[model samples]
Target: MLTKDGCKQLRDFTEKNYKETISEVAEGVWFVLGAGHSNAVFVETDFGIILIDTLDTLERGEKLLGIIRQNTGKEVKTIIYTHGHPDHRGGAGAFLESRPEIIAFEPKCAELEKADLLQDIQKLRGTRQFGYSLTDEEAVSQGIGVREGITHGERRAFVSPTTVYRQDTVTREIDGIQVEMVRLPGEAEDQIMIWFPQKEVLCCGDNYYGCFPNLYAIRGGQYRDIAQWIDSLDKIMSYPASCLLSGHTAAVLGHEEIKRTLGNFRNAFEYILIHALEGMNAGKSAEQLASELSLPPEYAELPYLVEHYGCVEWTIRAIYTAYLGWFDGNPTNLHPLSPGIHSKKMTALAGGAQNVWKTARKAMEEKEYQWCLELCDLLLSNDETACGEALLLKARALERIAEYETSANGRHYYLEYARELREKNKKG
Candidate 1:
């Protein structure tokens, strides 16, 4: 959730840059660009049209189907999934009129069911990251740079695949289109890349997208294999792809352009992984690694490498945690006191809640928002009566910080915290 001003800034940015439209990437291939924070690609074949991932919800899926009908009017003979992400597969049932043959890499029905068990917590965190729970006035866009479509009732649109490829790589001749799908696990466990030998078109799922990919979602999940992800990118780079269509954003045209883009994308992640590991091997803390690691000017300057969704520091932390567990080699944290207990002691040492609150207000006035938040935390630790003023100060501080953030995820997290504070105040 964003404050009014913050939301306005986001909306303005989105209006200028995030508008989606349909386009023909190749002779017979059409892209339903940015339909629902994701894109669906339809490939015309001799047998019929081969539909790629189905966007987000049923409504968006239906809208895409309408576009397909208007353009090719070819009945869907085959449906292929790039991954198991909701945005990519949630709208599967929307185009059931043709009863297309569905395909995906090694069916994850059981795994998906297990993942669904944690949906309660996942959805909560997802709402914060996506501003899904934001009020209309306070809501804006997501990391994909589009306003997420609201879904109603049950997600009855997602349909399971009829055909599952158990091998690492499989080739099929679907409707005269020589389709090659390789299991390149990276962004998601069930991720795959589809290559059209005849057309030389490569359909990369969320693995290769416009913005810096989410190596580690703030909404917690199993560790994404960074090394495996890098290897997967290398595999895609091997292809002589004239046209590159991704899960989100528009298609990248020309072979040279696709190569350059994918090369830089791979290097960006490799750069982060190398430097972070180097710092880690040197016994540096995650905080220190995050602060010290910096992308070279060449890699940092790319439009697609913008930290709009994934932050390098967050990736560093994820790498650290994945390899070394939660213990950051800090003895003080080995058996730490509860945050509330520690905060209570600290507030007493700072004189009293009144003195701390005064300092917090002064910090806010000086635009030292980080300091203000720290001071407010101390005050609210011991005194429940101080919560209202402290929360207000914290919310304001967070909102101000969110305004300057380039990463939408960073902005959303800050704004979400502010929303939490405001809601708490309202309850009181």
Candidate 2:
């Protein structure tokens, strides 16, 4: 968790460097930041312009495109999608006035089409993860990247791809500039990297960002392929690019700086992978390995590598889960009862729900938030009368944690649950 000072420092730095606005990344390439929610890159060429990723809504896209017109006065002739994420490709239709050629990986397009099957659940989880339900002050402190508050009505402006490629490397020459669409599946199964060979500028989608890469999203999903993610980093590192741009955060300039940044990013994952594998081999439990794994002091010192997005402990568990199943080889866990069953029994042993609540309130007063939450959970599980008071305690505990959370997502998760609890209390 970040200290209050740490969060304020990061928030200020981001607002100054990469916050909601349009900025030039290279000679002909511009990075359009949708208030740190997502980024779209546009490359100017003789024919017109090649756009990479559109902002979330048609309104935001048109607004950004207007800025691009005033700056470069170029019409968009082509569009490239880094992945199927809505924030990256949602405003695609806003450029239809130029009849631009839209490009995306074949599988990514398919995923978007099938995403509707999980629409309701995904949207609900997304709302919480993004803190869309929170007030301005609460939401701003929740996470990094574009912060969404106002809703855009009739927002569907996504354009179907006119060109879909399946190869690992798809080459194209838009007007006069040579562009290579390199498939590097990390973050998402069909994620791609746009490499402008002539300019020696790389647009690294979500694969590379200013913060520690999210190896596993807390909102929930299948385990990310850490090996593939590491390999993707290696592939991008091999490029002798002078500029590195991403779908989130600010651009990385200069050849040596880009090289060093990519090298360190790759090394961080390698260290986690190697140590976790070693721990597993030595018969360490997943929990034990997660608690023990830590990045080197040098890696830890890099502000860019801070747990702003993903934490080392979560990465350790994810790697362990990927290599081994959920069994964890613990006999008790293999046949454990439901969570509520354990909570109910634990509450009884602690001298009934009232005793647990009294103890929890005392812990809360002492700033022992974790212990308060655990004790509150025990009481809430067994006694309906304690729901209102228990939820309040949980909310307090969560908010306290949020105040010092270093990971943006981690802070969001804490505050989001607290908000949920407060809402539940209002209902009753």
Candidate 3:
């Protein structure tokens, strides 16, 4: 649970950064923001409208359709998915009444099929990642941009893609609008960017959002190729897009601003990649590299590069894991004791479980929350039934850490765990 001040801080951040609005980015291109966890853009042509990336759920999609109706009575002729992410295409059924031709990248269709196999676990992890368990007062924005509508309703009216393209770039003239769908996977393996040469507008799927790119989602997914993602960013910069619309955040209007923003975003990723590889070559473990790495002041100050969504430390660890699988070349780790046994030994070494709890309390008093958490973990793991106070201490430390956490995802995880601890303490 969030304290009053902590809740206020989150709410203020959301109010300042994620206000809902719609902007006519180009002549007939309108970018819709805050309708859902993700954004959507509809391009009107002589024949009809081309909708890119439907917002999250069916209700939100209906709302977006209403917004489209307000501007032009032209029905949605075609729906193009930027990627296979549920948020990008979940609301397709809302537009089924119009019988729009649904289109997706070939690989994306396969990705969706694979996702269906693990849908249950994926949904569970996704809910925790998005902080769906947080109360209304405790919840803030999704940390990408949107503040509401993600968990509004679970009715996802997903429609399968009718058309799939396998080419690197597919050119199509929908109605009178000439568009190019360029394959540039970044956040998602099957991600693509829709480029309008005539309008000089580019709808970059999840490639470029407001915050630092989620190089690795904690919710769990396949390893994101950092090199491939950087290459994709370069591909996006190759185009001279006067107006840039992304999957989550606000649209960038001018070409110069778009160039500078994309350049810096790409550089930030490159900086992390280069440094992590260097550290690995020097025989530093991923943990050591993560602790030492920090973005330069130039890249750090950029509003878009903030760790509101993805932390740099997590990215560093992800890079290490991507290049070299789980083992950090430490033989001891190959056959380490189980966490339960390890914690019991640590508790015994600290004199007793009560002694560990006392040390944790002292660490908390010294504002060493991380160390306190480790101590509390040892105590609880050794004997959870006998160490009820350790649970409360851990919950307090988590709340204190979450109070100042910059990353919304990190904060949510801390607070949610804290809530669980308190509930467990009550039951104990």
lDDT per model vs. reference: 0.79, 0.78, 0.82
TM-score of each: 0.91, 0.92, 0.92
What lDDT is obtained when candidate 2 is compared to the true structure?
A: 0.78
Q: Please provide, for model 2 over 206-320, each residue's C-alpha lDDT reduced to its tens digit, 9 standing for 90 to 100.
A: 8987778778776766678888888998999889898888888778889899989889988888899999999998888889997778999888888778777778888888888
Q: On a 0 to 100 scale, what is the lDDT of residue 161 in model 1?
A: 90
Q: Worst 10-residue stretch by lDDT in candidate 2?
A: 147-156
After superposing candidate 1 on the true structure, give the runs of residues whose Cα lies further than 4 Å from its correct spot: 1-13, 107-118, 135-137, 151-156, 383-386
**lDDT per residue, candidate 3, 199-318, as tens digits?**
999999999978776788877777787788889989988898999999988888888999899999999999999999999998889999988898999998887887777788888888
lDDT, candidate 3, equals 0.82
